[model samples]
Target: MLHKWILAAFVSLLGTSSLLADETTQARCVVDDKRRQICLDHPAQRIATLSPGATELMFAAGGGDQVVAVVTFSDYPPEAQAIESLGSLTRLDMEKLISLQPDLVIAWVTGNPAEQMERLEALGLKVFYLEPRRFADVSSTLLRLAHLAGSDDVGQQVAQAFEEGINNLQQRYQNASPVRVFYQVWNDPIMSVNHEHLIHQVIELCGGDNVFADLPRMIPRLDTESILSANPEAILAGGMGEENQAWLDHWQQYPHLHATADQNLYFIPPSLIQRPTPRLLQGAERFCQALDEARAKRQ
Candidate 1:
C-alpha cells in the first residue's frame, strides 16, 4: 500500500545530499526519540509538502505562499487544496515530484517507506521529514518551519493564538464537567486515539473522557462491543464526509449507546480534529463551545 520513492525523495532532502547546497548558515539537525530526522535550515522557498501533517505545519508557519505542490490528501486551509496534487502519501508519483522541481520537499518519515526515501536521496532532492508524536511538538515543528519560510512573525502569531485557545479550554474545563466521549477515527471494525496522542489530548482538553484511553496506539483498531460497553455519552466521529453518512447514521440501531439512543453522535470534519495545525485550536475552541452547550441542555 506504500510507495517506496516517496521515502527516497524525502531522505534525499534532509542532509549531506548532493542537493544540500553550501548554505550561509551551518546545517543543523535533530533526531527525535523515534530516530526520525529533520532539517532546520537551507529551507527551500518553492516547497512541496508530501503529507498531511507537513502541509498543516507549512500553513501554520505562513509558508503557504512558498508551497509549490502538495499531496492529494492535503485539503485543509482551502488554500493548500489549490496546489498541484502530487498524489497520495502512500502512492507518490516520482516523475511528477522530480518534474515539479521544487527546491524543498517535506515528508512524513513515519508514514513513508524506506525505499522511497533512499530513491529521493539518490536523485538529490532536499527533503525535510516531519515526525510528530505529541501535541506540543506540533507547535515546535511549526516554529521550525516558520523560521525556514522566513515567516517567524506569522508563526509566532499562529502559535500564540493556538496556545491561548488551549489555555482557555483548560481553564474552562478544569475542576468542572467532563463529558464521556467516544472519538472514533475510523470504523470498518473501529478505531480510536490513544492517551499519548494529540487527538486524545484534544478530547481531554474539551473536558471529555476518551472511551479508549487505555489503548496504547495513536490510532488503534477497536471492537464495536467495546463501544457498547463504554456507552459513550457522545460519539465524535473523525474523517466524516458525504460517503460515510449512511454508515455513521447506523449507530441508531445500537440501543445501548447514549450517543445512538439520544442521537448525540456528531460528525465534524476530520481536519478540525485530526490536524495538529494552528487551525486545531480554533476547531477545539469552537467544538468545546458546542459540547458545553450540549452538556448544559442535557443537564
Candidate 2:
C-alpha cells in the first residue's frame, strides 16, 4: 500500500492533460499533489517557482521563459541562476513576489513554509503543490507541468526520455548482487533517509540495501556508533558542493570499518540526487557505477 500522498500523485500523473480546451488559449487544468483541481483560464504566462527542484522541473517542462521568479539556490540548468530571486523558500519577499504577479506558482509541499503558500492561495494565485517522492512522480510531473505551461511537445519528449533512462537503469541493475549501503545526506547531525525517501529507492534500484531503510523517521539523525554497528559495505555521501570531499574524507578515520578499509566511500553530487527531477537518472547512473566499484573491491 502506497502512502496517500504518493498514491494521489501517481493517479494525478496518469490524468496529465495535454489537450487544450482551446488551442488558441490553453485552459490548463491539473490535479496537484494536494488533490485540488487547479485550472488556469489561460496558459500560465508568468510562473514563480518557490523551490530549487520546482525551478528545475519547470525548466525541464520547457517553461523557462514563463518562469518570472525563483527562490534561492535554483542554480541548475545553468540558465536558472539568471532568473530573478524572490529570496529563499522560507523567507520569501512577499512584496517582490506580488509585484511579479505570477499566474502560476509551482510550490514545494514540504520544502516551503505552509503559511507562505496559504498567503499565495489566499491572494488567488494558482498554486500547484508538488512533492515527488518516486521516480515515476518525477517524470510524470514534467508532462503535467508542461501542460500547465502550454509546452506539451517539449514536456512529452523530456518526460519520455526520463522514463526510458530510468527503465534502462532498472533493467541493467535489477538482478545484480545487493551491496550494503549507507547514504549520508548530512554528516554533522548524521542524517540518513529511510525507505520512504527517493534516495532509498535509488539504492534499491542499484541493488544496494540501505542499512537504515527500516527506520521510522523519513530522514533519521544517526550516530557514528550506530553506523558502525550496521556495518554497511559501501558508504555514499553528498556534500555542500560538487567538489567537496570533506564528508567522505571524515569517514577515513574509521579504517576498521568495511567501507573505510575497502575505500568504498563515494560522492554523488547533492544537486543531482537530492532534487527530485529528471536529473535523478544521471544521479542514479552515477550511484550504480559507484556500487559496481564497491563490488569490485570485494573481488
Candidate 3:
C-alpha cells in the first residue's frame, strides 16, 4: 500500500511540472503601439528590425544578436550597418526578408508601409509595431522588445537607466528660464513641428517655447515672412548630414532676426535629435546647453 501511494505522488508531481512548463511557454505576450497583443509560443531567437529607430531600440534592449535583418539607414551602433538590409523605409526587399526567416519583426508604426506590414503578418511572421512618441514610451519599448528577445534582464537595466537620465534632465531644466525658439525641421519647404510633436516636447524640456506651438499641423510649412514676424529668440536646426552646419548658417542671412542678431542659431545632429532612441538624451543635453548660452548672452 505504501509503495502504491509513493508511485501515485511521484506521477502527480511529474504532471504538475509538465503543466508549469507549458504555462511558461504560453505566457509570452506583449502589446504593441497599435494596442494589439502579440504572442509567441517561445521567446524569439530570430528578429528583424524594419526602421532605424527600431534597430537602435532592439540593440538597446539587448537583442542585437537576435536581429537577422534590418532596413536602410539603420546605421546606429555601427554594427547594424553590416546586417542584411531589406531595403529602404518606403520599399522593402520582400524576397530577401523572407529568406532570412525571422520569427519576429520589429516595425515602425508611422514610418513603415502599412500594406507591407499586413503582408508580413499574412505570411505568418510575428510583427511587433513600435511608435514611441513620449520619453516613457522609449523605456516601455525596450522592456517589450527585450521580453520578446529573452533579454529582459538587460532590457530592464537599460530602460531604468534611460528613465533616470530623462528624469534628471527634467529636474535640471524644470525651473530654467524660457527662451522663445523656432526649430527648423527642413529648409527647402521651411518646415517646423507643432506642439504635438516629440521635438516640441524636447524644446519644452529645455525650457524653450516653440514659436509655432499653436500651429494646426504637426509639420507646418512656413514662409520666411511668418518666421520674421515671430522673430524667435533662438533658432535650432538639424541639417541633411550629421556635421552639416549650413542650415544654421541660412539663419545668418536674416541678420535682423533676434536669433541671428545674438548668434543663437544652433546645430543639432539629426541622428541624435531626430530619431527617437537612447541618443535623444544626448541631444537634449546639447539643446539645453545651447539654451543656457542663449540665456547667458542676455546678461
Number of the top lDDT candidate: 2
Pairwise TM-score winner, candidates 2 and 3? 2
TM-score of each model, in listed order = 0.81, 0.93, 0.89
What is the per-residue lDDT of model 1 for residues 22-101, given as tens digits with 9 covering 90 to 100? Answer: 34464544333344564545545788888876887898788989998888778777888888987888888888888888
Give lDDT per model, in order: 0.70, 0.88, 0.85
For candidate 1, the TM-score is 0.81
Ranking by lDDT: 2, 3, 1
Give a tens-digit lDDT track for model 2, residues 56-115.
999999999999999999998899999999998989999899999999999988888999
Number of the top-ranking candidate, with TM-score as the measure: 2
Model 3 — TM-score against the truth?
A: 0.89
Candidate 3 Cα lDDT to native? 0.85
lDDT for model 1: 0.70
RMSD of 1: 7.4
lDDT by residue for model 3 over 1-299, one digit each (tens)? 11343234323422443336546564466778887767777778889999999999999989999899999888899999999999998899988998899999999988889999999999999999988777767777887787788787887788777777888999999999999999998998899999877888899999999999999998899999989999999999999888998978777899999999999999999888888888888998999999999999995
Per-residue error at 275 for model 3, in Å? 1.3
| Lowest lDDT block of 10, candidate 2 | 1-10
